[model samples]
Target: MSASPKYSVELIDGPSRVQFTSASSILRPDGYHPAGAPHLISSATAEVYGNPKATKTIRIGNGGLGPTGALRQLCLAFLGERPDLRIDWVVNHSRHTQVALQAGSIDVALTYEREEEQAAETEGWSRTMGILCHDHFIIAGPRQDPAGLRGLHGSVGRANDVEVSKVKPLSTVAFANIARSQSTFHSRGDGSATMHRELGIWDSAGVPPREQGWYKVIAGTPLAALQRAAADVAYLLIDRATFLYAHHIGAVRDVEVFVEGGSELMNTTCILVRTEERRGAVLEFVEWLQGTEAQAIIERFGKNWELGVPLVTPVSQLEVAPHGKRS
Candidate 1:
């Protein structure tokens, strides 16, 4: 009898039509025939080539535990936009999202801020999709109330004597105290844009280091910073989502949300599709992300009380609740 043909399809781009054969024994049981080429895509090139027409495999680059990763998962499940889509996820610090997307290593990416997209354009790449979710930067520290930020704020009955004493210059006092007390201050790495933003406030307020010993720097992701704070019982700046998730993982324990209510404290996240060709696909996925179905999944997927839905706030007007204030 003649052999039944099991035809294989090979996908390639550009004029290099060279073909090579793979060893028969190496074929995957799942039928994934390994290609005999580099078979790697840079994020920048992917942006130019566009996303695959019909969902096949999507290379998704994610930064970290914050909203970026959460948003991607929501797009996958509730949106049902790419049901069969296989996502190759690369998780790392938040800053890598743009680099991976631009390198063509990923087809789509979730990130924060618009500046990353601008950089993509300078390199001849287009960011086809966007979403603005309200995120907040918060202060997490040991539950012991060390610097007595909690004590300073005080309770309703006693009132925050320290806070009340510095009413006219509350922001200044807060920054100065954190700057002066090493025990009260720590941050996640020097390159972190968010950390830089906070430092800027200290500069503007003329809050000099209370003493060289009063400040410390912890280098890592939100989760790492959270862990450092938990271990040393020190204060560190972190995003709300990470703080919540870190607590659930037990990476950090006995922590509390001590700070809120500031212009610099408000944070936001966004999505960026690598190329113009895949704009439709990216938008479809983004819409699904914001859809009620996806939001529900997001609500459940995050760590116990640690994960939160992206902020659905208009950029023009943003506000956060005060420490003792309730909305």
Candidate 2:
């Protein structure tokens, strides 16, 4: 039948061009292809090319458990405002994100790991653009409050005794009590921002090295670690956003916010941009995040009927420097 009159078809859509032949099919360079189709021989690969003046793609590395979602929303809004730009988000915890930013794999990073930020600045690999938002860390535990941390909530603001004033904050004192009582305590131990804060609290409390039986370290995300804490009735240090989100979604029911509020528990999320060719766009995005419109979105995030409270406060509401330093 003379190969049924062999025909060639070329389809050009957006930034990709696909060619199909009667004898064979080829994969497209856009990384997409029709499913449930047999692979064919006679390879004639498709070619994909962007227009000479097409929009640029900005890659962002994010390392926060709760703020990641809100940042993605802000990115969508920015993209809408600037059609000439697109975004590719690399979501990982603070450690991995910091590594990626240092390795030149990402253009900008939204991170909460203070050590990583300091190290990057010292190494001259990245510089802080501004503070994105802030959320307080809260100690969550079973409603029964085995460590009696609920009572310490009142002491969050006052230091009645000189020894208490010299000691760590009330939240850290709660951790100290938990350690002394041999009550179960869950630690993320995954180099996340939350873990960083938790470690500081433990250090300030002068708690000994984590014991294996009572102190459990889960090398996982905050949400997963919180779930483990709930299952085991252990105490946990978590950002307000993650706790509230989990509570709203029914991921956390037995746990209650035991201790919160204080300068020690203030968590600031910062924007760090790599020193690279796309510095201008990265800086623009960072500046936009602190603007009125972006701040509005951040202030309202996680404030739906299910949660009834916002995850983070806008940076404008606080006295944070443009470079994310305390003013």
Candidate 3:
């Protein structure tokens, strides 16, 4: 008869998580222990503490705003102190960002669509941290001004002189004229936050661009749409930052700012945290972004460079309502 064999097996649980692999050894007929055959481990258990410092990457989705570049620069500067930290930026339109956030593909999103933000909050998928900055949308077109928006600008200037409400009425009239004249208007058409704003303006004006030959939908980024507009000598509704960036980069020379400085044209970028798992880092980043140091960086963004003008106004200087509440 073979001699009985004795062996020991143990599992230790420590404060930190640990994984274990199983190995089986056979006792030889001569009472000699043989090396275990190499086999795959069937199962293992690991404990995770969910430490923020242990996180490898902080995923961020940007909605293609000009200020996003400054935000990325600030993030890199902040990460320099913590060599262990990293950032993964997913630059997309605001609508796509919302989808990614809801799908848990990204941890946070920076977007300019207030309605989408409110919907996410209502759906309990995310919450807005705060307003990062405010930028105004401007109508740009060929220097010839085919739509004759100068008259509208003059009217707005006169209204400002008298402290009367100018943005809504003038904007309505401008859209009416665009529709009336059938002037070519290039739309982002990419379901971006900017596109959402454009739709709102059209809706308020009671003139939908649907089936309108003069309204062209360019399904691309804001910059791409702007380039197409410039090439076609068409009018385009673009954010101030993107227009200035294009000018700075010499991407478009023919398009000029036709109409600006309206409350309805206000573009508010809001920060949102997708989940609670990375809430610690996200909250810290948000607090830092809203602080004086970060605000100062935002205030100086795109200034003294080739643009010669700041792309976005900091939240501090702009009076903005919190997300879900618009003034």
Return the top candidate by lDDT: 2
Give per-residue CA lDDT, model 1, range 57-80, as digits (tens): 555655443333464554446335
Which 10 consecutive positions of candidate 2 have the poorest summed lDDT?
A: 41-50
TM-score (C-alpha, index-matched) for candidate 2: 0.74
Better of 2 and 3 by lDDT: 2
lDDT of 1: 0.50
Candidate 1 — which residues are off by over 4 angstroms?
Answer: 1-55, 66-73, 78-83, 115-124, 151-173, 208-211, 296-327
Flag regions of model 3 displaced more than 4 Å. 1-55, 66-68, 154-167, 319-327
Instruction: Give the lDDT of residue 85 in candidate 1.
Output: 52
Backbone clash pairs for candidate 3 read none
Q: RMSD, each candidate, Å? A: 14.3, 15.0, 18.6
lDDT of 1 at 139: 66
Each model's lDDT comes to: 0.50, 0.65, 0.64
Sort the candidates on TM-score, descending order. Answer: 3, 2, 1
